[model samples]
Target: MSGSDTVFNVKPGGALHGAVRVAGDKSISHRSIMLGSLAEGVTEVNGFLEGDDCLATMNAFRAMGVSIDHHGEGWVRIEGAGLKGLQKPAGPLDLGNSGTSMRLLAGICAGQDFDVTLTGDASLSKRPMRRVTEPLEAMGARIETAAGGTPPLKIAGGHLLKGMDYVLPMASAQVKSCVLLAGMYAEGETCTTEPAPTRDHTERMLNGFGYSVQRQGARACLQGGGKLTAARIDVPADISSAAFFMVGASIAPNSDITLENVGINPTRDGVITILREMGANIEVLNPREVCGEPVADIRVRAARLQGIAIPEAQVPLAIDEFPAIFVAAACAEGTTVLTGAEELRVKESDRIQVMADGLQALGISAEPTPDGIRIQGGQPGAGTVQSHGDHRISMSFAMAALRARGEIIIEDCANVNTSFPGFVELAASCGLNISQN
Candidate 1:
């Protein structure tokens, strides 16, 4: 669907029931493309994210001299170029709106002895590149970017990259993974300390693929110069994407939702913990392990939600899910306050300001902070919302509208196709009252 034609109009509830399975995990989907392309032999990935962002990584790898064949039925076969074997692309690689592709690939390109230009879609071009660029530059990679560390980054190779210690200013998986990917070719041990822990999929996947990586306390260290071997990876359903449904079932009157095959990696399970604390009856069942990541079935039943303060330390874990979380807060019994999360300002949009605006448009009282938003919970008076071209923003508030007083329409909803391609259909299947406008 074209971006302009994407608007979702959601009606009030048909209360949720039955178990629904989400698609592949977004984090694992990204790593599968990246690591598989650099391995020594053929790698097979099952349950990979077929969304635009992961697809951008696959296309970027193809342009960089990796042989990849997409056989029908969710299976991708990659004949890797081996570590240090990537060829320079013939022209500037376009990354669409995927920050994951640009950041992780920056490290891949830096390790090679070739020069390359990388550009992205308008949205990607605006996201801060410094998070990844700063760390790469510290490792002897030369990168020049637009003013204030935005994209259209020009990275020239040939510098001798020596791994060094880096302390992350914030919890960012992309930045952490970028440094680690470059460290794979560096001359010595590379280590990073975080202000708080972020998603550790890259670290775990590296270990699963036969690379020696160790994590201790707040630090994750990698022994540089190890070759990655091809391995099969099974991506669990994304907990981030499943958040909307969780919120939906939590707020919709008398609804009970079972979300199956969802990832419950501790670093990204803050939503569950926070929701459970808010008095939502959510249960995790059938816990299992896949490729070192925990997978579980989530069951959430509607209840009277009571909002509480979210700690600064937990901000990064639930950062991407906050917009929808605010929608959850709007229907809770008290006020929800969040802090220490300035990162939300630079996501697909200025999420703090945008979410505040959307909530106000819905007749829900919302206050904005320099870093976060505070939402006062009560019954919402319905109105149309603008997603600002953000997928999470589109689906999250749409769930909120399910229990709202009147009709709710989300404009510029095309971004949902980029991540959750069947969002509208899946919501409908879960007994949600939703449709595309």
Candidate 2:
């Protein structure tokens, strides 16, 4: 299986059971690489996600003179390049399918003394970059994107950025982090006010590295002159990755599963909140703090779900997990209405439209709204759905087979390695009758 040539064949009917730990947090993993590479000393990271996306981040830093040693099984050591130490790559830094790498690296590269270009695979090339570039531009960083603000970002270095108060046009952590990361090299204090709270991993991790990021209400501010000292990071299991199993165990009959060491970061736990609001049987166990982020064991069991309008406030919190959330809606007892999520339109795929089309193909009534979607709970029938090279969409539809009336075959599933690398094997271990070819 390679590229978009992979397909997933899932049989109807199964119950997910047992305790499993998913991959390390993708956002945290990405930030660890970025911050570690920029810090003053060797940063030892435990529980690093070895997914293609995060690895792409690692490779990008390595191309800039940072030395990173992979010690296998979720452990890595990074030799810092300091705030102004990244060298110009011989060519464009290929980030593969990682938007995080392209966006965040654009910020980091903006203050360097050498020019660099950031490129990606076909799918990532089509994703927008202006959200970060426009703001970085406002801060005096020179960046150029292709038409429609897409990827292949060429960021001109040696620009002296000056800190300014930035108001985010949307609730995007990547954009906020972009501005904040670029702020590190700016002339004064940099602050960003978001319309809604996003994952604060970058802010938290920055502070962990001896840099101070202040948060008051919806605003986060930091001074540009501070230097980052290296720190150890133990990434909790990604709640987004745990979400598939959570929804799987919630919807399937007699299914009960416990996910260990999952990060329940307040800003990123909307999926759990939404599912619970829809009558999911979920329990938060052994809640504690891990390196300034909250961690917990989540237990989810089968329940009869009744859908309601998803809270608009939680949209930013669970933005990435909506693909799986939509699957839960299809199996619920009523209609699930989602709005205030126009962000879905610009993800790896137009999630709202893609999920709606796939659900409709599977005999469910899913209407794609401009900002969100309307899903009518009903039984899913047999279908061949297209993932469109989107990993989350492929995995979401695979879980749909649990309540499907017949077998479900998902196309273009090879991108699952971008996030959850061993998805098929891990899914099978928990009783998901899935195979890939």
Candidate 3:
């Protein structure tokens, strides 16, 4: 994970069977410590993501004078500094490659009195912050940015942010969470509406912390100035993380595997829906509530998958999984066309072009559209694939490479550490012959 490139060697496999638990829900893990550090008392979080990105967020908050302690294992105790208590850190908060941290922190900073400036790693710095900053300004916060509306945001001393019923041009969890966090300190009812739904981890976590947040239609209404209370949360397994397994089982012939503790939040279940629509045998087993979010064990069995047109409505739900979805598309019975998903261009990579390019290199006919991709499905061809320095793209092709008619090699695999840190291990455990070469 510390070099110029990492490589993945994926071997074909037989049916896969086992129960594996992934890292904690990354979205909820970020919000827990954040909301906890600002609540009235200490919040206990179990199953927190130990990933680099969430750790960056934790470190940034600690620099602001909040108290957070790691317990035995997979547990964290965050002491609330209370609302309006985050002192300015001595330096620019370095959010290394985490757009989640950069965007969510932008909103949190909007209501603070301290003079704070938010910065990020090379990749994070390149992501557009204007989406979050634009809304913050309408709330009466002063924010300055660089050209292209990217990061290294200069946030002046906070102001009395007024709550507004802002409408989002795009459906993004980061943007929605940013506005909701800012609403915590606003003076009135703060609300946000999106053209389409995104992840609602913040709203669920806030309710778990005893804050009353109501959702109306596409909008979430938050009563400003309501203090968050101490609570215990067991972060569910990340659905995004589980997506790798779903695609792995769905494509590997005769495979059946179960991923435990997966978060089944309605907004994040797009991957499951799309795969089931393609005729994969996946079952949601022992579904229950942990804290306030839904959790389940998902069992996936490999089958002959048939392609179907992916609706634009489902785009917002499965936005992050298209790289892997494209893998499913490659093996589906017919042409799979995806539309109304232009956001894929701005992720860790231009997923549309990167996937289409990589698939083409493997002899699959894939074309990147302005909004999405169209693919001709069949047996995967043989060739080397590039990850484009994007974690999901790297892993998606690694899985796609498994079904290749020839040995598959993936370049630039170190990016997998950003989200799913031990991704190669997870793949190997699932019976794929994967190695770091």
Candidate 4:
């Protein structure tokens, strides 16, 4: 579907069944392209997500003189340019809707010998960039942003950066990874202490590439002047993408589903933890290791869900899955309250407000707060919900259709390709009557 022409029509009363494996982890996919581009040898990646977001990351690296061969069927070969080997791109790096690409690449561009400008789509351009620019500037990398600290970032590279100890005001893996990537070019050691843990894909991928990233509790440290050797990476299924089905199966009656080869890294397993705490029946089976990260198969069965006060400590862990979790909350038995997640306001869309509006339109009682939202569980009637160009919001509403009273129309769903390319097909295969038009 054309970007402007994409929409989703979902009918009520469907259940997911059987087993499925979601696309490659979006977080790991972006890092694979990035770390692979900077390594010394050829990096072979299996199960790469062919989504627009990760593709944006790949294309950006390609513009920077990285040779990437896309073999059909999720196989990619990236010819690594050793650290400090990236050439200046001829024009601005357009990162599309991927905040991950824009922020993470800012760090990689910080130590280069050339000046670069990074821009994104309308939605991404509106998101904050100062979170990254501030830390990069403190390390002596000259940086500029649009008014209100938005994107269209102008980064002046080749400056000597000095390492510093930084404490993150919020638990954000993107910001943490940004500084860590810049730390690679700084003099001496750089350390970051987060208020809470975030995803560790960057750190693990660094170790897989033969670079040492030391972690102790909430703090992680990395040294400058290191080399990365290209290594084989088998990207696992993304838990965030699987979260829709996880919630779908949990809320829909007589539904049972298994998600295979999902990355269950401790830092990224917050959704599973939160769901279990809310009385979801999810099982972790056949645990193993893949490319330095933990992997397992998850089986979820339908159960009566109860709303509980979500612990703030789990906010950062399950941040990306909250949209889908909110759908589960609407189908739950009580009130679900979440807090300490004001970061949602600055995502691709204002997730808290957008979700609350959508839920209210569906006839559910969802109250949006400055930091979080409170939802009262009840049957959702048919309604049209706008995605606001956020992929998670689009998919989350689609999951809600399973329990909706009538057909639900989801607008601006084109962005679903940003993370999960075959979302409609996958959902339909598992018994969801969802179609893209």
Candidate 5:
């Protein structure tokens, strides 16, 4: 978890079995710390993601004088700092590889009384911050990004922000959440109209904290100067993390596995929908709600998948799960065509290109387009692939080894801890012949 030189060696031929629970939802874990620190009372969180990214969020709040106690194993207590209570940090906030932390915090810092600078590691530094910064600037916050609209985002504080009705240039929950977070300190109502529906965790969590976010069709609107009241949050297992094994069980022979307590928030369930459309045998068992998010146990069995044209509408819904979905496409019986996912080009890596490159290295026919990719179903042949330090890419290829004809070695997998910690150990326990070095 501490080095960027980690490698994963996965041997071919294994069937995933038994029940497994992934780490808490990364997106929700992030928002919990952000909103909790801004609330008026103490907040207790269960199933919090202890990944490096969420820890970065916690450390950021702590640097601003918030007290967060980690009870270990997915439990956290946040002593709220209240609105207008956050202090100026002693130095720049280093977010490591967490774009979520950097982007969302940019909006929060924009409305602060003290100047704040948000920074990140190399990968995150290259990601586009203008998507959030431009919108926040429109709301009357002074934000300066690096050349070409990247990070270390310098937000000049003490500006009285005035909210505006904004239209998102793209479908992004982070951008939407950023503007909305900044709106809390604005002088008027802030509204975001998305071209397509993205995750609504921010809206849902705001309601949980006794803040009102109005939803009408594709638009979410909230007035400024609202108070956030502390509440208990139970973060569900991240479906994105569960996706690797879900694809593994679907592709590997005699594999049957149940993923427990996973978040099935409708906005984020496109991965399941896409997989099911590809002929995956997945069942939603014990569907329920937890902490304003849908939760369920997912049981997936080995099935002969036949790839189809991925529905464009589901693109924004499962944006982060496409890496694993690509692996499923490789093992399926026909070609998988994905489009309306240009967002993939700007993630931890150019996921569209990275996944295509990895799949091709393993002897799969993959062609990357500007927005998406077309993958031909086939058995993967062994080869070393580069993960570009992308956690999802690393895990996706590891699962690909299940159907590989030879050993698969993945390079630069140290970033796996950014999202899914203990992934190798958990995958190994579930019968994936994977080892970390």
Candidate 6:
């Protein structure tokens, strides 16, 4: 399967059973490459995600004079160039379908001493980049963007930047991390106040690299000119990747599955919280810490779910897992209302609209609002759902097939490789009758 030609034929009538470990955390995989490239020594990373998005991040760093050795099977060694060591790339850095690479690299590139243009594939090219560029420019880094602040970002480097206090209008980890990465080269202390809590991977990883990132209330601050020493990172299984199976086991009858070594950082565990509140049976076992993030074994069993009003406080925490959570909502007994998630509109696709459309296509009632969605749970019928080049949307609809009355075909599923590579095989190992064609 290649590109848009890829499609998934998923049939109903299987209950997900047996244990499975999903791919390593995509967020952490990206950050490891970024931070490791800037550290002072060799940074060894185990369990790195071999997905296209993370590979794009690695390639971007390689373009900037960083040496990364991939030893097959998720182990990687990156020779750091230290701060102020990345060389000018010979051409525009192509980040493929990764918005994380483009956005975060924008911050890192702003602090460099040479000009670089960051470009991406069709889907990523359409995503707005001004969220990071605006703040980078505010800190005195020169940046030019496409019309309407889209990609093909042109950044003129070698500018001396001065850090300033900035309050985020929206809670975005990418935007926050972008400014923080640029802040490392700025002149003073850089602080970011969030309207709501976003993922703190950057802060956690910064601390692991021997830099100090202070957190007080909703604000996180770091000083510039701090050197990052190399460190070892064991990337835990992604909770977002674990979410599909969590919902699968939760909604399908006679299903029970355990996901091992899943990262359950308090900031990123909203999916578990929301599902448990909806009356799903989920247990966190063997809770421990791995590489500065919380890890746990999650056991989920099928339950009769009853939808409740999802708390607004959890919106930022579970933003990425909503598509799969929406599938769980469709299988629940009542209505699930979600709000304060307008950020979904700016994702790889407009997630709120795209998921709503896919759910409606599958005979579920989902109404899209400007900032949220209202879903009425019922049986899902046979239908073809478009992924809209969004990986989560494709996998979410596949999970929908578990409870569906008939077969469901998911289109444009090739993008699944961007995050969860080998998804079809893993889903099948867990009892899903899904295959790519």
Look at candidate 4 and tell me the lDDT of residue 236: 98
Residue 75 displacement (Å), model 3: 1.4
Tens digits of per-residue lDDT for model 5, 1-437: 44457999999999999998988999999999999999999999999998999999999999999999997799899999998999999999999999999988988898899998999999999999989988888888888888999999988989889998999989999999998999999998999999998999999999999999999999999999999999999999999999998999999999999999999999999999999999999999999999889999999999999989999999999999999999999999989999889999999999999999999999999999998999999999999999999999999999999999999999999999999999999999999999988
Task: Please list the residue runs of candidate 5 whose C-alpha ends up more than 4 Å from where it truly belongs after superposition.
Answer: 1-3
Rank list by lDDT: 5, 6, 2, 4, 1, 3
Q: How far out, in Å, is residue 117 in model 5?
A: 0.6
lDDT per residue as tens, model 4, 267-381: 9899999999989999999999988999999999998999999999999999999999999999999999999999999998999999999999999999999999999999899
What's the TM-score of each model vs. the native? 0.98, 0.99, 0.97, 0.99, 0.99, 0.99
lDDT of every predicted structure (CA atoms): 0.86, 0.93, 0.86, 0.93, 0.94, 0.94
- Model 4: residues with Cα > 4 Å off, grouped in runs: 1-3
- Candidate closer to the true structure by lDDT (higher is better), 1 or 5: 5
Model 6 stretches with alpha carbons more than 4 Å out: none
Question: What range of 10 consecutive residues in model 2 has the weakest lDDT sum?
Answer: 1-10
Model 5 earns a TM-score of: 0.99
Q: Taking the tens digit of each residue's C-alpha lDDT, what string does model 6 give over 1-437?
A: 35688999999979998878999999999999999999999999999999999999999999999999997688999999999889999999999999999999999999988999999988898998889999999999999999989999999978999998989988999999999989999999999999988999999999999989999988999999999999999999999999999999999999999999999999999999999999999999999998899999999999999988899999999999999999999999999999888989988799999999999999999999999999999989999998888999999999999999999999998889999999999999989999998
- Residue-pair clashes per prediction, in order, are 0, 0, 0, 0, 0, 0
Better of 3 and 4 by TM-score: 4
Model 1 steric clash total: 0
lDDT of 6 at 316: 97
lDDT: worst 10-residue window of model 1: 71-80
Please tell me which model should have the higher lDDT, number 1 or number 2: 2
Per-residue C-alpha lDDT of model 3 across residues 134-184, encoded as one tens digit per residue: 999999999989899988999988588989988999999899999999998
lDDT of 1 by residue, 126-171 (tens): 9999888888888899999999889899999888888888899878
